[model samples]
Target chain A: MAVVVQFAIGLVFGLGLVIAGMSNPAKVLNFLDIGAIRSGGWDPSLAFVLAGAIAVTFIGFRLVLRAAQPVFGESFHLPGKTGIDARIVIGPAIFGVGWGLAGFCPGPAFTALATGGGAALMFVVAMMAGMGAARWLANRRA
Target chain B: MRRSLCALAGAAGPDSVNTEFTPFASFLGGALIGAAAVMLMATMGRIAGVSGIAVRLLPPYAGGDVAGRLAFILGLVAAPVVVMMVTGSAPDLHIEAGPALLVVAGLLVGFGAVWGNGCTSGHGVCGLSRLSPRSLVATGVFMATAIATVYLTRHLM
Candidate 1:
């Protein structure tokens, strides 16, 4: 049941990417070109995808939170935070640059694999390794 | 209700910044994702931080946290379907590589999500906004590797 939901979610997210036209590498690559945004000639179509994703999720969260225990468990578990720092700004700027260039982030890339392809596969693998290395280091240091 | 409201608003023309996540849309798509992440955390006590949930799937996360994780994941997957059903027309899509490369990319990303403590979505959107030191480092690594990978593949020998 849980896995099914996960798959469903991934599928929808991918579908959203498809609908928003985010599945295209060229579009994403174009987004990365800050000069485009600066030139005021930027194609803001990707923004629509972002808006749709955010809107749908925002609405969904409202319902999900109303539940004491999401159909799967008890109470919400959020990461702790006190104030904004370098991580907040620097992290996004980095992400924006990559996202702007590659045109595909991790989620849609892997999900695209379900339908089948190479670029998605490459992205998924490298993304995993990055995550693994981060975890190992965090644990070791802890 | 909300959908209709959005429709009414979107009808405002091209200046709105659709953020539709499609090459055909605008920065509004990114903004939407960002806003969604913020609203999600504020409402659900969870950061729409996907990388974090994916990480919890490993050995160390064998506890009950999986349920919420499952739900968050589910919502993401469901959104697209709902969109297609409602919109009638689906957006365009294309991948640059073949199957073999896509698989390798998937695994590498999975590894990074764990090591980075969160993927860009989790850290970049949620963690970074909240000022998490860990998210900062993870985001840095995400970019460095991506640039290096793209550079090596797209240019240098």
Candidate 2:
């Protein structure tokens, strides 16, 4: 039942990415184009997407957290880390650079796998490799 | 709702920078994504953080419920197919960068997501919704750097 629910959620999220035009890298690139934003050229359509998602989820969290426990799980699997370490700051900085360069984030990049062709494939593979390297480094440090 | 959002973004005339403004579609899709996130939390007590989920499925990092992770990933891939079948519209993909740039960008994103502990979906959306401070900072930093990078790449380069 849990697995099925996860799949269903993924489906909805994936469909949203496609319909929202997030699956297209160009849309993202355009949104990040600061010059355009400055000149009031092409307004960042994604700001709406982000705003809409955040607004709904913000309300949704308040409602859901009221429950003693999640409907299907015994406890919520939320991130517990609260410290603002170097990892947190530096990591996003690096990710932002990549995101700005390619306009491909994980969700949309994965969604792009359906017909992402060579570029998308290359990205996914390289991304996996990077993740592997990070894990190795973390394990070594630990 | 879409109109209001577009208006808020200053996308009123045909001369707007984003001439291909699809506020209705974008807002509807965003709402769906939000609904999915809420459903995941309410039903399963989980955060629908895509990078976190993807990392768990990778080798050496695979420890948690692998079956569930695989199922969710399969669903993500199937989404476009379902859309194409229903709406008969193919998504336009514009990746002008060559494989070298793609690889570099991919590597950076993967490493950063792991180090930072979340990606856009995880930190920017679900985390921010829950008012997580770490997520808030991460989102701000990433957005600032992303805007800067775009400026450098497109305008300066």
Candidate 3:
């Protein structure tokens, strides 16, 4: 039952990515291309996407978190760390470079795998490799 | 700064921005995504962070609900098909980066997202919704850097 719910949620998430035009790298690039604001080529669609998503999630979280525990789980698996650290800053900075370079964030990239052609496949594979490397390094440090 | 002024002056025209703007679709899609995140949290008590979920499925495997995670990913991959069925066409998708650039970008995205502990979904949506200060910082840094990168690539380069 839990797995089924997860799958359904994933499907909704993916469909959202598709409908939001996030699966399109060109569209994402247009949004990222702040320089184009001068020439009037900038796309503000992504901003709306972010705004809409955050609004819903904010309200939804407030409502759902009121309960003692989740419907299926004993305890919520929320992030506990609160400190602002170098890792948080440096890591996202690096990710931003990659995202701006290719316009493929994880969620959109995964959804794009269905019809995004060969480049999507290559990107996903390389991303997996990078994830593996990160995991390895973290384990070594631990 | 001068260019920003020009943009403001020209903002009245429909063609002033990218013509493909779909504010309605994007917002609806975003709402759906948010709903999904809420559902996941309400039901399973998990954060719907894609990078975190995907990384756990990798080797040197971190133990958790492996099957559930895989099912979620599989569902994501299947989304386009559903779109096709409903819309009578596949969703528009185009990758601008070349193979080499994509490989490099992919590695950076994977490593950075994993190292950072979240991506847009995790940090941008879930984190921000929870009003997490760490996420606010992360989102700000990444958005600034990403904008700079795009400027460098599209203009300076």
In terms of DockQ, which candidate is strongest? 3
All candidates' lDDT scores?
A: 0.51, 0.82, 0.86
Per-residue C-alpha lDDT of model 1 across residues B1-157, encoded as one tens digit per residue: 3224533453211121222233434334454465556444444456665666665655566444566565655565455445557786434445543344444545555554554345656765555555567666666666555555543433232
Q: Residues B72-107, candidate 3: write the lDDT tens digits.
A: 898899899899998899988766577887898999
Model 1's CAPRI class is incorrect
Candidate number of the best lDDT: 3
| Candidate 2 chain B, poorest ten consecutive residues by summed lDDT | B10-19
What's model 1's lDDT at B59? 55
Tens digit per residue, CA lDDT, model 2, A3-91: 88788889999988887888887788788886775555554668778887888899998899899999977888888899888988999
Query: Candidate 3: where is the Cα deviation over 4 Å?
Result: B1-19
lDDT of 3 at A134: 79
In candidate 1, stretches whose alpha carbon ends up further than 4 angstroms from where it belongs are A37-41, A57-64, A85-101, B1-47, B59-120, B123-157
Error of 3 at B97 (Å): 0.6
lDDT of 3 by residue, A9-92 (tens): 999999999889888887888898877877778888999899889999999998999999999889889999999988899889
Worst 10 residues of 3 chain A by lDDT: A33-42
TM-score preference between candidates 1 and 2, better one: 2
Q: List the residue pairs that clash in candidate 2.
A: A41-B17, A42-B17, A42-B18
- CA deviation > 4 Å runs, candidate 2: A38-41, B1-19, B61-63
Task: Name the DockQ score for candidate 1.
Answer: 0.22
lDDT of 1 by residue, A4-108 (tens): 544454444445455455555545543433333544534456445544554555455555566675444345766665455544444444443344334456655
Ranking by lDDT: 3, 2, 1
